[model samples]
Target: MKRICAWCQTSLGEVSSNIHSEQAITHGICDICLNNLFADRDIDFIPFLNSLSAPVILIDDNNTYLSANSKALDVLAKDHQFLKQKRTGDVFTCENAHLEGGCGHTNRCGGCQMLQLINDTYEGKDSFDHVPVTLFQKHGDVRHKLDLELTTEKVNGLVLMRIDSHK
Candidate 1:
């Protein structure tokens, strides 16, 4: 695959600046296009994410959902409005999200692997792919566990947490 800017389609030379630069891949925006891609005061991520087949959720530094594609919203059985007012945990129906401190402020949050992944990606630590995660989901009065595979990528300071597959 040819390394090219996701936005301008300019060849990124031989190196792939994407999250998976270590591997032979071709998908990511170039440095020159980064500023303009995000410069718009109201950046709309739905169009970008809509191109993917998987469930993709766009989250900010505080782990708040900025926007999600149809597949993502469908995964949560929610609409755009529902996601706008909720965080990742709330959208995923994490059992611990209902606690006093809510999403990221609870004691249990300390051991949250997914949150750790997000933090790592934000801090430019490393990129991850197909990482397995077990989350307990609450539906009405019942709670169930879901084994999901996560693919995290840092794009323009925003983490695109893509749900690759689930069981």
Candidate 2:
């Protein structure tokens, strides 16, 4: 049978792998579907997030950055262009981000609470509010441990990672 994109019903060709196989991956959406869903108009979220006081960043399923509000930009101490093409670690200047593979590719990423929270929320497993997290941030070759509070909510098929408070 031919596989199809769950979101847009586009044919993806035959399914060679068995559902019972551990290596088999069932694709719910195609790359084109993802691109279309996250097209240029995705930035429209910025204005909406701007209405809120918290720092809000939109992330996709793979933990890739989508867009961030002005408050988020301020919190990261960077402009929109700087945040562009950057992952979570790059945006927050995580120490692991400077590692060989960077961000999600590092071994430390497996135990990352923020990543767990984002994945859980994305899978509809849980939601969080003002959850405290400790992450290492790199500055001038020195790693600083930062205590931060995070709030996450899934809205309009996108996950919103909001920086509620930092200490």
Candidate 3:
């Protein structure tokens, strides 16, 4: 099979039989390409998901980190424990968060634009949709206010996540 790395336009050097599944899925970029690509990421560019109180970190597409809110961080941590370790692949597995039997994954935890965009992209085959998210935040014993916008864009086949905040 002929494919290009999603993060970079590098010619993958491997024959079909020379590939391993887990690390060689060819999802996007070559390991080296991703590494070089991430090296250019702003080491100080912190996108805070919260405007008040303690801060949280957001692991976007390809392990890029952004700051998040306290409550939202809790939800992501509890719901996405593997994020702290793996920090890649499909982070949100729980669907039907809006359905009756759904885990309600979309509620009050800010918007999971990454997960939702991944779903639409995968499920629709050729569609891109931004998930609509609404959340309420509470700090310790007090609830702070915020509005969040999450978005995803595919660059060279690599999904880049975006989060916007309002207070």
Candidate 4:
């Protein structure tokens, strides 16, 4: 049976050693890539995330919610609208997006490089380190360009995802 890694979708390699024996693992790090993948274990990364120019969110394993910074709340949340919805995908909508019908099902994010980065990590094919991506967003009448630097590492059993924007 050929199994795929959730982080990057890579074919599971020969199990030289089982990191999560019962759950399963790929290479040295699958879900336990960052030593720990939980919230409590990510306190140290707080300072690092806070310093980022772009917003950042530490998504929990359930893909529901975790933690975000002030800048993130401002750009990502946009006056509690997104937080009220409780889903990042909801808040970052592209319905009125001149390009595609919406963000989720558009060429903007559909063929997004970030998604590829995530796919690579989930498949255990890429390191998920310092991967650069460009995303499309509508800022008023202008379609702004956002350079996304995504790093998917584990923190206290959770995915400590850092998303920073660049010019």
Candidate 5:
């Protein structure tokens, strides 16, 4: 199998394998590409995210939201101050998040597809598109069921999670 940089299509290296008859290609970002993509952080931070049409949120390994684009803010109905450093459940107003232990620590968290997708992408250093997710959101005294499709990409040290669609 061959590992290639997804952005520049540059070959990183090849992996020895005897399982497959045909050579397969795996995608990942190279160090140079990573640096180049994030070098101009000051100017490109918000603009880069804003350029994306989907509602995108940048999250760390701990599930802390680092940043969100305008689309994401509009969808989430929250500003940067409310999202920054907040956990996924808290940001989305998940009912389980308000319980003891909070967010990922709650018993119900185990079945959360969105959290699983984020963790899987981060751990595997892979990207996933159009993954179905169902979230139980709480607002005032009502609990609402949200069906959504999510796309996640591992960008450097952050996971770019996009709300592809919602219903």
Candidate 6:
């Protein structure tokens, strides 16, 4: 089987396989493409993120917000400083994040589709697209339900989560 870079289509190499197949191809990102996609030393971090058209946020393996694009900051109604180091639930104002255990530590988090998606992406699972997510946010005394669709891709040890649609 041949392994090829999914982004640039560069041939990585061939793997030994006992089962014969006619030029089977496996997909993966090459080092050059990965660096180009996530790390461009010439470009500023915020600017690189802002270059994307969608509302995107970069999260670490632990699901902490490392940075967010301008569109995401606007959509979330928060600044970069406020979102940095915060978890998904906290950034989205999920009601459970305010509980004793907080965010991922809460019982509700186990059933949270958003958290599950993030975890799956961080663990090197295939990227997700247009996955539906529901969040219960507490605003003063009232709790409001927010519905969202998200797409996630893992790159350079971080997950880029894009908010596809929300209401």
Question: Candidate 4's residue-wise lDDT over 77-155, tens digit each?
Answer: 4643344424334445333334444433456555656545544554567446556876656667677666666666544
Tens digit of per-residue lDDT, candidate 5, span 36-144: 7666423345665775566888888898887888999999899988777789998788889889888899888888887899899889745477889899898989989
lDDT for each residue of candidate 3 in 132-157, tens digit (9 for 90 to 100): 54444444455543344444434333
Better of 5 and 6 by lDDT: 6
Q: On a 0 to 1 TM-score scale, where does candidate 3 land against the true structure?
A: 0.31
lDDT of each: 0.75, 0.71, 0.40, 0.50, 0.74, 0.75
Clashing pairs in 6: none
For every model shown, what is its TM-score relative to the native structure? 0.82, 0.72, 0.31, 0.49, 0.75, 0.76
Clashing pairs in 5: none
User: Which stretch of 10 consecutive residues in model 6 shows the poorest summed lDDT?
Assistant: 18-27
Residues 15-44, candidate 1: write the lDDT tens digits. 533423532111465656655655542598
Candidate 3 C-alpha error for residue 152, in Å: 0.5
In model 1, where do residues sit more than 4 Å from their true spots?
Answer: 1-34
Tell me the spans in candidate 3 whose CA falls farther than 4 Å from its real position: 1-83, 86-115, 121-132, 154-159
C-alpha RMSD values across all candidates: 3.0, 11.4, 12.4, 10.5, 6.5, 7.0
Candidate 6 structure quality by residue, lDDT tens digits, 1-167: 57766567777678434321231111244567657866633334576567567798888778688888999999999998888779888899899988777789987777888889998887877657788999888988899999998888776677878888989
- Residues 21-102 of candidate 2 have per-residue lDDT tens digits of 2111113445675555445544555655565556888887777787888888888898877777677888888888878787
Of the pair 2 and 6, which is ahead by TM-score? 6
Q: Estimate the lDDT of model 5.
A: 0.74
Candidate with better lDDT, 4 vs 5: 5
Residue-pair clashes, model 4? 22
Which candidate, 3 or 5, would have the higher lDDT against the true structure?
5
